[model samples]
Target chain A: MKVRVHVSLKNGVLDPQGRAIHHALEGLGFDGVNDVRAGRLIELDVADTIADEALDEMCRKLLANMVIENYRIEKVAA
Target chain B: MPFTAAVITFPGSNCDRDMAVAIEEISGGTVHRVWHGDAALPDGLDLIALPGGFSYGDYLRSGAMAARSPVMQAVVEQAGRGVPVLGVCNGFQVLTEAGLLPGALMRNAGIRFVCRDVKLKVENASSLFTSAYLPGQTITIPVAHHDGNYYADAETLDRLEGEGRVAFRYLEACNGSQRDIAGVLNEKGNVLGMMPHPERMIEPAHGGSDGRKLFESVLHGLNALA
Candidate 1:
């Protein structure tokens, strides 16, 4: 199975990298950019028998820091 | 009894030697340099220090990987037994990531690496690591890091203030830390994590002696217990 985890800073948490990117885009003369928030996408290849609970555990334990980030899991078609 | 301390060295920890020397000189004790792969700490240690640097090269967030290294498990266990732990800079990040302390160190709000001496006000001078300083006293220490902004929920921040667990606060903005907090103590007051490098300020040659009092305070506190 192929799994993808999307990790992003929570809404209230500040994102300095995202802000820098937003500023860079403005510097390049791009318009209509109100805000920017950056996140990470991690892909994994796991056994077909891997349970959903195990995937959730993976995210909770190591894939994302719950303190300031949230994660979503997506399954890709084989 | 002779004072004893251990300084943990993760692969990229550059300040371990400095920490060891500071502890040895201030406590007049045996200071052991422990490796990250070691499963256990030397027995019956008085203090455990986690020094500053890009541990594990700051991969997966600063101090995140190193917090899970084998040695940290023992560090946590020993800390649970009321052993004093002091973590500076990356060590502060590790302490938060390891759940030994609350909150997290985020990217500096200004989005730049900050390195220089800054003024810090002693917020709580009665902790095991702060007994030598007077309340509200100001001291100078050097802080070098990219992700030093401290973040926690409003409720938690309020609780930390109410409990007087905030150990040091920047007199002027240094890293965009919440409430300008520079250092914090655990609920039990046995653990401290800060962004500034107190070890770097322990001598006249190093710029000033403001940091020496911190080491001395810990030494005197431990001796008192003994």
Candidate 2:
């Protein structure tokens, strides 16, 4: 099994990196840019029998800092 | 038994030597060197210091990986027993990631790796780390980090203010930290995490010795307790 974890800063939290990228885009003459926020995607390979509860625990423990970020797990067939 | 302290060194830590030197100079006591992979801390430590640097390569997040290292488990345990721990710069990030402190340090608001002497106000001078400074006194300490912006929920921020947990505050815009907080103390006031490097400012050749008083104050507090 393959799992991808998407971790993003929660709303109301400042994303300075995202803002910098937004500025760079505007400087390059890019248009149609709204607010930009950045996040990370972590891919993992695991046994198919791995339960969602176990995956959630991983996110809570190491994959994401719950204080400022949120995470979602997507399971894909290998 | 005079002011024994330990400085935990992760693979990329660059300031452990400086921290050790400061402690040795002020405390005139044994300074134990501990590695991140080590599982045990030395017995009867008066202080534990997490020095500044890109620990664990700052991979996942600043200090995030190092926070989960084997030694931090023991560090956390000792901290629960009221052991005084000081985390400077990246060390501060580790403490927050390790759940020993509140809030997180994010990228600088201007998206720059700020490295310079920043003026800081002694917010809580009574802390073991800041007793040498008068309340509201301004001191200069150098801050060098990219992810130094401090963030916490409003309630937690209010509580830290109310409880005098804010040990130091930036005197001017340096890293865009919330409430200009540069250092914070734990609930029991035994653990302190600060983005600025006091060790860097200890020697007169570093241009100022304002930071020396902090280490001196720690030793002074310990002696007073003894």
DockQ of 1: 0.77
Residue B65 of candidate 2: its Cα lDDT? 96
A1-78: candidate 1 lDDT, tens digit per residue: 899999999999889889999999999999999999999999999999999999999898778889989999999987
lDDT of 2 by residue, B88-185 (tens): 99999999999999999999999989999999999899999889899999999999999999999999999999999999999899888899999999
What TM-scores do the predictions have?
0.98, 0.99
Chain A TM-scores, one per candidate? 0.98, 0.97
Give the true-structure RMSD of model 2: 0.8
* 10 residues in a row with least lDDT, candidate 1 chain B: B217-226
TM-score of chain B of each: 0.99, 0.99
Model 1, span B31-95: residue lDDT tens: 99999999999998999999999999999889999999999999999999999999999999999
**How far is B56's C-alpha from truth in model 2 (Å)?**
0.9
Interface C-alpha root-mean-square deviation, candidates in order: 0.7, 0.6
Clashing pairs in 1: none
Interface RMSD of 2: 0.6
